[model samples]
Target: MAKPIARKTSRGADRMETTLNNKVLTEIWGADQGVGLRVKQAALVVLGIAILAVAAKIKVPMWPVPITMGTFAVLSIGAAYGARLGLVTILGYMIVGAIGFDVFAGSSAEKFGLTYMMGGTGGYLVGYVLATFALGLLARRGWDRSFVWMALAMLIGNVLIYVPGLIWLGQLYGWDQPILQWGLTPFLIGDALKLVLAAVILPAVWSFVGKART
Candidate 1:
């Protein structure tokens, strides 16, 4: 899994985790699945989900959609945690939201079931799962620490989200809605900015971790 390396400032719990994470970095990444986690591991998974949920609340209303730190949060978390944990964390968040916990962008799942999947933003939500997985791949390669790589990764992640989003939007709004009018017209600049933000943050995280190791 790829993610922004949270700066581990202390030497007890934080250092221990940092060290262990470093050691298992390869193993967690090498397998089709991630490295196995026991009880302690499960706890970390839940914690990651919580982190994303908290970030969601600190959002603004941006154009083309509700502006939120949710995507940035997920990308960073996925880059930090790797695929298995990243995926589990997001799914956990989704599961909680579906039960009507206000964890998603819009709050309320509207009955919360298969019906939600057929809704307007469902495809984008599904895309979150994918974006994180890809971020994990990059994180494993140690590109999580590289700015350029992170930018590219974030762009790809957004594209992955958008592809399904556009298709679903067309299905819902009809192809006559004018592609430029609803597809990417309002969000292109913002998407670029988000990509830049991810690039800056991911490398800073890598730098922080590298410095810590030293």
Candidate 2:
């Protein structure tokens, strides 16, 4: 009697997606799954706001200019948290600042709140939202998983931040003023270093996660 041949199923037939599409660090961690959707989102937003606050004050000693980790936090959180959550987190941070919380690097008790936000850093704040969205979007495409792609994503994110920042400085001060010197040139070294750091960190984190998963 001839036995019927058995068929071999495809590899990982029941496994989750192996590719990095639509999956971010937060989703992989599944921390939000422990609570309701709104609750998880709210908690993440609060956590993000706190992170931004702390990052705003952290200064790494470097050449030419000290590197503030605020922008780095903004970009990293956006990539890790995804677009919608990142946007809400940034808005929440802004609201906290607007209500006079001294949550900005350049703001103080005497000069905090809306008055401070509407000053020099206002345009950069707007850029924060845009750059967050851009980073989130790029992360969705798996750019955060590789050194080259993550570096490119960070570069794009920085550009998104700087363009509006420079424009705001020009409009706030004047075109004849040294807008480039005041807002762009001096910070290039710090930004470049941060960019390299981010490029290294994100990919390394992903690699660590990959190894842990196996």
Candidate 3:
């Protein structure tokens, strides 16, 4: 009886020691953690942004604007990073492009012009930031796994990006109807495909990554 009690005491003490150690370590690293995490996050966002531009280069020209894989990166990054970080990353990319960097689609280093980069799909670019917020909202609510929910997530993302994009495109063409003609009509099918693909892949990627983390 004494032996069992002693053993139980030993186990309890060990568990307590472990918990204390964990708490201490967490406290020690907590401040650095926020900074480190932000740095790491920014790096990932930059990579995602670069990938967006690279994807555009792989475009298969179709209509008003060429269909590019950039949209995939846009939608995927949001679902992957959640709302806040996703928005930050895409917004960071836009800021970089806006500040006269050739980081946007078709803005070759040789040409290196900001006009095309900021003018053509600028609305969509801004919209991408909004999409990230929308996508992140649904994903955090545990809708990341459902196809219907994920599809809705992507659809909302597209709408967020496209609507403002259409308005801007309309402005550019100096015609109110340019949105219907240039923005929405031209990219409907392609955007739908991109949304479907994002919806399919985001949950799987997150799930796989989650399993690894666990």
Candidates in order: C-alpha RMSD to true structure: 8.8, 3.6, 7.3
Query: How well does each candidate superpose onto the true structure, as a TM-score?
Result: 0.74, 0.90, 0.72
Residue 45 lDDT (model 2): 94
Query: How well is each residue in 39-98 modelled by candidate 1, as lDDT tens digits?
Result: 546776788778877876766567666566777887877777778778888888888777
What tens digits encode model 3's per-residue C-alpha lDDT throughout 58-110? Answer: 78766566787777777777776667777777877777776777766667656
Single out the weakest 10-residue window by summed lDDT for candidate 1: 23-32
Per-residue lDDT of 1-214 in model 2, one digit per residue for the tens?
2332222222332244454456877777645455576687888899999999999999988777787999999999999888888888999999999999989989987899999999989999999999998898888889999989988999999999999999999999999998998899888888888888888998899888776764
Against the true structure, whose lDDT is highest?
2
Model 2: residues >4 Å from true position, as ranges?
A: 1-10, 31-35
Report model 2's TM-score to 2 decimal places: 0.90
Rank candidates, lDDT, best first.
2, 1, 3
Clash pairs, candidate 3, are: none
* Error of model 2, residue 80, in angstroms: 0.4
**Total clashes for model 3:** 0
Model 2 weakest 10-residue run by lDDT: 1-10
